[model samples]
Target chain A: MGDVEETVADVGEFALIRRITGGRPKGAATLLGPGDDAAVLAAPDGRVVACTDVLVEGVHFRFDWSPPTQVGSKAAAVNLADIAAMGATPTGLLVGLACPSTTPASVVDELSAGLAAEAARARVGVVGGDMARSDTFVISVTALGSLDGRAPVTRSGAMPGDVVAVAGKLGWSAAGLAVLGRGFRSPVTVVGAHRVPAPPYAAGPSAALAGATSMIDVSDGLLADLAHIAEASTVAIDLVGGLIPVDQRLIEVASALGADARHWVLTGGEDHALAATFPSASSVPPEFRVIGSVTRGAGVTIDGKAYTGDPGWQHWR
Target chain B: MGDVEETVADVGEFALIRRITGGRPKGAATLLGPGDDAAVLAAPDGRVVACTDVLVEGVHFRFDWSPPTQVGSKAAAVNLADIAAMGATPTGLLVGLACPSTTPASVVDELSAGLAAEAARARVGVVGGDMARSDTFVISVTALGSLDGRAPVTRSGAMPGDVVAVAGKLGWSAAGLAVLGRGFRSPVTVVGAHRVPAPPYAAGPSAALAGATSMIDVSDGLLADLAHIAEASTVAIDLVGGLIPVDQRLIEVASALGADARHWVLTGGEDHALAATFPSASSVPPEFRVIGSVTRGAGVTIDGKAYTGDPGWQHWR
Candidate 1:
């Protein structure tokens, strides 16, 4: 028999919350955690960076493909990525969970464990949360971050002649998704990337400290996100196809699915990689690799040419 | 033709967000509002109060009974009430919306207008939000607040001799719900209270300055919420039935539905009223009225008698 577990209805709301928050360790930023009407978080810099994201079942994840732990981890990662993209250090997280009453208690426990583990990885704390009963599962996370007195690296800061660079791996999440959809036997590393993305959390602040002119997290494909930077900064961005790093596992998965690896590298999203622009290539940190350069124009391009493939992920579409 | 409108799919995600956030007034605490990856809010007191609440379509509200505007207002009110309960001045809100792709663009616009209107009432800004496509509608709001250097009032701070007081009307929401369910033509004041509660946003800080030992927002009935205070503070609370405030409209609606107004007053949830404990009745501010007193024991009693009705709203139940 599998592990025995009770439903949320059996334990009730307050008891379930107690079970979720019982022994969790809080960070210094969390002056007061759960059990209060509202959690108090220390914002020593006098300014707080806040962002929110929601994941709906069937649209964002499938229970058959992603376990509760992965769902929670993905939710936390995406929200944290937004904070990081703003060149802020994440401090606290508030989660709103909606699930069926018949959901197993172990699912909630595992989900909370995953969320706390991810937050701990970034040295942040889960401060407060709300839970309710719904027909399908939904995970909504809001992350609070501190800028530490540094000027926020906005997308509007990039200027022509700035060098474009990236700090983390890309294409793996989309490649992983493709492999899974095609029922291809692939490496666990590639498959896991789709279920739970590992974002470059520290790279955001590092890029800001290194004098990044502009920055954004690669959630929607590289070109799609860069287009936002280009529009906001009012400058064109040109990526060198050979300079952009591609993982070997992603290449293997793409090949197995008979899909173009370059397509995934250019348009695949959900990797949450950090992309930024600097005044010069020399100013780019050791962790970041120069992929392209900014130019005086509009929109993003690859090797001085427009991308003719599907742009990126659109929620409504 | 009743006002032609475009669907979310026609406008797309980015355009829909722009339509919702464009031309909105920002409050003083909003350093950087929507459009960026994240919003920046000032936390001048070095601490920020954070809370979250989720409202599912059928469980929280019905479109047949309440308009989209009322849904938005209710969502903002409940979350803002949590911040007020902490004796903090609310500064900003982050919303996450999930609805079907077929939803009209005007519906989203109306919802945003409702949220912005309610936020403006408290001098707070609707800073940022995330939207996704789902089969059913869901609205999740996270509120951020500042203590402005004042100490936060917690539920565990109640002393044995503390006098219990409340600063807002009660039982109107529950009575209104009963009246609506019974198809009784009740006063709009009673019915509107259920659709969108008017929480006393200012009385929280006033009570804190008057030395309120402990405070809570009456979201889950007076007895249930006070029981939370009693458990947290490890003390017994005796509420005086005669001292509890009952609105005339609430009584009329209760009588029309053949229900007991006293029962509704004792067990009604979602009133968003401020309930607190002070050192003495005289310490309570003019906005607040004395309702009971804390004692040395455990559990909450009404005039020294144990209540035997349903405890309160249990989400899972």
Candidate 2:
């Protein structure tokens, strides 16, 4: 938006950062913000929950396919969801961006705008970060959260007979990915879901308050993530096929693509949905839908049957 | 360590991560360790100082010149220094490593070993991380620290007449760099210093307790970093050349290479020494040496004269 054309190399790293953060609003929890060596965020609960995620060009997202802003938002959102999954309230984020010197400054600006927008939506602040030069674009984000004095909801807490429930939509992101992979021209919602996830930010602490026995963010598909809970808790998980809450758009898109909606719902990931186990006699939270139950076994099964289909998303496959 | 000769690609990202972190000793502060979505750390002070740093291949370090261990240690050290600079004690670290699919799992293990060793030295735990495939190797580390309820010592607090002092060795890293650049193989100490910096970690909080007017970690050159303090505090910094306490190794190497040791001492960065300003009349801490004074102007000058040499290291230049 400036009259003059200048590259990120021309402005240098520090100046570029100052320009990007200028006039940006910092939240109340940001005791000391970006200009310093590190940011000080108010914990309020004597504990901090932290997580980090890295997105690489071509490997994670192609610039030509995903806008810089969407990439930025997704990068921050996934990390935030990890903290949320720990039953913590979001507080602040630190971003590490590696891009080629030839990258347009405008792309970086849009990325910042997207990061700021997502942080605001999550009610967190962009506290501090480091920028560096690289061959390909890479954005690594670390999100910090406050536990609010509650015990962290861990995956190993689930016991036999605990009811399993999910707090957000599933299968939509995987369907979105399928549509994007197929280069479908119609169905904007499916494509949007793939580009930028809408993780249920408030549902994590809510589930904790509702007495979640064990929890995890749905990253490596429902079955794969649940397998983590199963392994940690040393219990078997049984999901009811009819209980998976999926979007209609995903069903329609999957049908049109000749792909199984159940496969997408079960093996698809990146939705960042919070799935947890609760006591069978306990009341479920309003935001959660009962989808499964924990049993006295060693692995996860669907409808009391072993799933012999695809495993899940593998990072370096 | 095992009979399996699996590459990172062969094992896949998640599996490789599980392998690397499986038997490591998690620190006391890590209540919830690596398997969870997010790691929870004890923040004792109701506040955390957080920061992230990205080190990219060729831009930040060269694998040929720096061993994988050095790369891992330096990456963790820089991020931990940010926490220390905030007058906080680092508690935990989250690492994100992006590497080519063909990278050996052994290398990943050694890198993790380096990270663990560094975190131990800093009295922090390596909590959790993400691994992904990329064309080049990049390491992104986020460090979390506890402020212990003490008010953060910021760069904007220096006042006129405050004595500018630095704790720990200066120019040793830069001198070590010069030694490595010239292919000097005789002195391992110089090479080791260049590879793994020995920062005075405890001096940061000590400065805060001694009532430091302002504080910063000298990641950039002394003159350039001091300029940041000046800009933040609205004061000019005047360095007294006679007072700088540099290592003798730097002098020997500089003399051998016909380089100016003073220049290295003043402008060579990455030593990660804690630089702070204290009241002129107060007793200087044992770990620190008074090297300059804050004045009523802007920018930094050396003995009443502006520097005419290289400003400092430039990223990707």
Candidate 3:
């Protein structure tokens, strides 16, 4: 730990911000990017979908555990996932960073690099944001997205008999976390998965095009997130454990560590995977795999039974 | 402090959030407010101007000195003011709050009340937001506004010979802070001004309608904020100090306290006043008063002299 010479308070805020944002490529949709009073993004379809989230150090991520780049990338990725959950293509992002003055300039630059890398990966531009002073490091990001003439697939639109499906891998993130927690450093794949997530960037709008009735990103686990759809739509969701797909690497790791892979698949969070309900007549997108159906019920169930291992991660709890 | 009897950790994150958001009036623009994966706001004008800011306790505010309501109101007010600075009518706001688990529930409730009260004053709805655990209290807000068919008055439009004007009070907030810092609790007016700011909410769009060339909310001090406009537009701003219509009461406070009124007027920040430049021929909005003029040069000056006092408040400084 002493290997780190100085902290955030050492480098200062504005300089760190300058270092972070300097020389980053901004996307075309960002008519005006950062370094202004406010940023302006082109909303070609005339509508913008907005979402915000704040991730705090220690509570959201521990600096000792997560590298600076991972923190920045995850912050942008998670917020963009929310925009995608609304069945809209993300257009731009605004980030608010609060850190001590002594923070390393390199850390701040790496954070910006992570954000730019992730933004380019998602094809969304980072428009604007603010930097402030805080004792503990915190990053608050607000994502703006374009609807592109597509109807927003709200959470209240799911109906009975609608197919429930997911796009992107499940349980890999949580499995990776377990490996890290146990101090298992040798498995590069597991460690890499734990550090950064790859949310299905295209599947959100593709599901919308496939006529998804309701959708949400799986950041808080399959059961908990699906429960949101069920409660909002006033329908029940039944997920078949057999139909649920798992990453083979995650399965091997879980079995090797005497952990239940199904538990991780059902209860692990932070994958940023998208789960949506669609009409039976609609064809599932290539990125999505059908696993269950909506029904007339009050909550979500896994394999005809309530999950007893863990409910999932809750911010308040 | 011990008399407070509880901390953020004692109340927990989710329960406190539910309490904070319960029964507050959400304006019509909100399709869904809180309790969902993401809240939706109506953008009838087809475009949304979005901005975000984060405030941290000890760094941005002091709980012991400022009321919870004041903290809440200030948090929303500043963000809404940014939207207004864009010459857009704010549609909705989302707040992300992070507090220690030991924080009292009443504090959280009061904070919520402040947010609701300020939102009502700004005429913008409070949509959904995120709540999490943190060691210190942090409030992060994202404000969304609708342009209402008008082109946004960016800071880049100031031209030579443009008249610079302001709507709303300045120096009062700084004066108020002085009162708090010195523990001189005499004038209730100054205290109230510091506790909760009264931004010129209507003046932002009014300036746009009046054909103002460029505009910004005075978050930093007058000279410093104008410097931003000057840099962005590549024009010099010459202020007529005598023309700045500061409240005489502030002068009295400064005199009584043996402080410089001009210092407060030039360097005091957090007023949320709208500052803009208009072409000489353009009609000045009744809500704004001309205080300066744009010229061919660089940076901001007062009475043909460089303001050498202080550049204004900066985060992490």
> What DockQ do the predictions score, one after another?
0.87, 0.83, 0.54
**Model 3 over residues B1-317: C-alpha lDDT tens digits?**
75867655666665666666667888767766766556666666666677888888987788877899999999998988988898988888888887777777788889989998999887766776777877768889888887788888898899998999998888888998888888887698987787788899899999998899999899888888898899989999998888987688998999888887778777888988989999874578888889999999998988999988877987756
lDDT of 2 by residue, A218-259 (tens): 989999999999999999999997887767777788889999
* Total clashing pairs for each candidate: 0, 0, 23
Alpha-carbon shift of residue B241 in model 3 (angstroms): 2.7
Q: Tell me the spans in candidate 2 whose CA falls farther than 4 Å from its real position.
A: A1-5, A19-22, B1-5, B19-22
Please give the TM-score for the first chain of candidate 1. Answer: 0.96
TM-score of each: 0.98, 0.97, 0.94
CA displacement after TM-score superposition, residue A271 of candidate 2 (Å): 1.1
- Chain B TM-score of all predictions, in order? 0.97, 0.95, 0.96
Q: Per-residue lDDT for B232-302 in model 2, tens only?
A: 99999999877877677778888899998888888888888889999874656788888899999999998
True contact recovery of candidate 1 = 0.87
The runs of at least 3 residues in candidate 3 whose Cα sits more than 4 Å from the true structure, single-residue gaps closed, are: A1-15, A18-22, B1-15, B19-22
Sorted on DockQ, best first, the list reads: 1, 2, 3
C-alpha lDDT values of all predictions: 0.88, 0.85, 0.82
Better of 2 and 3 by lDDT: 2
TM-score of 2: 0.97
TM-score of chain B of 1: 0.97
